[model samples]
Target: MKVAGRCGEGSEGMVRVARGPRSAAMPHLVRGMHRVLLALTACGVVAFAGPARADELTGTLKKIHDDGVVVLGVREASIPFSYFDGKRTVGYSQAIAMQIVDEIRKTLGMTQLRVHEITVTSSNRTPMLLNNQIDLECGSTTHTVERENVAAFSDSFFQYAVRMITRKNSGITDFRDLAGKPVVTTAGTSDERLLRSLNTEKQLNMRIMSARDHQEAFSAMKDGRAVAFVMDEPIVYGFKATDPHPDDFIVTGTPLGYEVYACMFRKGDESFRALVNRVIVRSQTSGDAERLYRQWFTQPIPPRGINVNFPLSEQNRALFAHPNDHALD
Candidate 1:
């Protein structure tokens, strides 16, 4: 039986089915097989039948066409990374997502692809990818060794160091310096994983609080419910800029670690992955990538409660300097 679901932007559309029939007369066994095939297709496991045609698209490309659009998962709350500019969306992540759509169109010999917006929080983004609910995620997601088990990452889109935000008097100087202090982070982010690992490996007594999203985590710290907020360096800077009492808080902590952010897909989609990589590469070479960054991160993100000046840290500069290659390590 045919099925339709609301993908990005709360829009109704049909998703790709590998073998489902348009009629309900199809047997349950066949439908089961169809689901399996769809899963395979979503992951790019099986190549489409017949000769590979430049005009014929499969996996994400086929889904994009069937839906008559591209569904991009993004966090409207994430500034610099992914967020809206009034009615229109703008950010480093959205810009890269658009580039990926262009590459998919070129690969399929199509002139256009529709863009659909999907709202996702930290907890559900990765799961959404595995279930085929999100064609591509434009939110800031870190690449980690353990996460690679289930998700395929595009070329490194951004990079930042993991740092801590605490009340100015809390006195946390560095990561290794936070021995027994409690730390807070959004649930399902690589920051949570990194903090936990450091706690164990360093043999330090650390209590960690998990928030459903970054906004929540920041609120906890602002309200003095938590001692510190741990996250990527850019996020910390953004928060500092918007805090009502910026001087009341201080962001300190040795670099616990570094992370590379990338767009995500279901694992095993080599063809789709390659297409995404090419798009970022093309954007970088064309100079559009730099322009997008300047437009988003450099601009004031008032309601987002954060603002970072143009040009990111020198440490994470390579993501902007070069493009198109995976930055997992």
Candidate 2:
């Protein structure tokens, strides 16, 4: 008698085995056993009959199930995207992350799920996610193809242009004017990458300085250590609105580039990524995301009563209309 066994890719592939003739009841027993084993494998309880591979069924969802906690990686001062509000973390991304947590709880059939918050800067956020130090990164992280190679990103929640913030009287109105000037950007950020590319391509001779985070970069600009601070336009607007002398600074120049902001997680986890995408899509289609956008962009936020007053751009509207995880060019 011969029986076919189904398997998945890799070691989990299906196989067929033949056995000598046996009692009529043997067929039923073999079939029953096969069904049970298949069920176990489907549940991620059993792998191929050998040493289990280390890469099997490990990701954000599995970790949440095992630990009963989901850690959120938040930024200290990415402004209305993610930021510290007094001792509490609050912002657009933070709010969206909480919604995801709620969905996770319901999906897992847990009455309560403990959430742990970890503050992450641009320099550490990616490594932290890769190391499983944080289950979800709810910050103003750009979704670039290079980054997507290492991490998974949800559909873009926000789109921003790369621009520079300089003193109004600095005579740096465009990217061309930045030649030979010292500019600061957050270390380990897309801003740094764009600036470097611009410097090399345009032969701008810009003196580039790296700050550990956005606040430090802004301070460098404030203290004259850097003639300009280059970052995402929304972030620049956030800092400018909160600055003591808002009129003293200006965000100028043609946009260097546009960035799509999305929540990040470790790669190779389709289930977890699908869950995150579902939540994001629902928010966009249900008007929930738009409400949050207005809450953060139009209304005043914490640390100070300041509003970025940024309306949703048409590009973002198109993104929400057809949510996708593809990196924008």
User: Which has the greatest TM-score?
Assistant: 2
Give candidate 1 misplaced runs (Cα > 4 Å).
1-55, 84-88, 105-112, 301-306, 327-329
* lDDT, candidates in the order shown: 0.72, 0.83
lDDT by residue (49-119, candidate 2, tens digit) is 33223345356776887798999999999898899978799999999999899878865766588999999
lDDT minimum window of 10 residues, candidate 1: 6-15
TM-score of each: 0.75, 0.82
* Residue 134 lDDT (model 1): 89
Off by over 4 Å in 2: 1-58
Candidate 1 global lDDT: 0.72
297, model 1: CA deviation in Å? 3.1
lDDT of 1 by residue, 1-329 (tens): 33333333532322234453367787889967766665444333456622247455678767776777778898865666776657766667877887677667655656765677888888999888888888899678887778888888877777778888888887667776667766789899888888899889989787889988887888888887778899887777667766677788787877777778888887777778867775665455445666776666777653553557747556445565555345554
| C-alpha RMSD of each candidate structure in angstroms | 13.0, 10.5
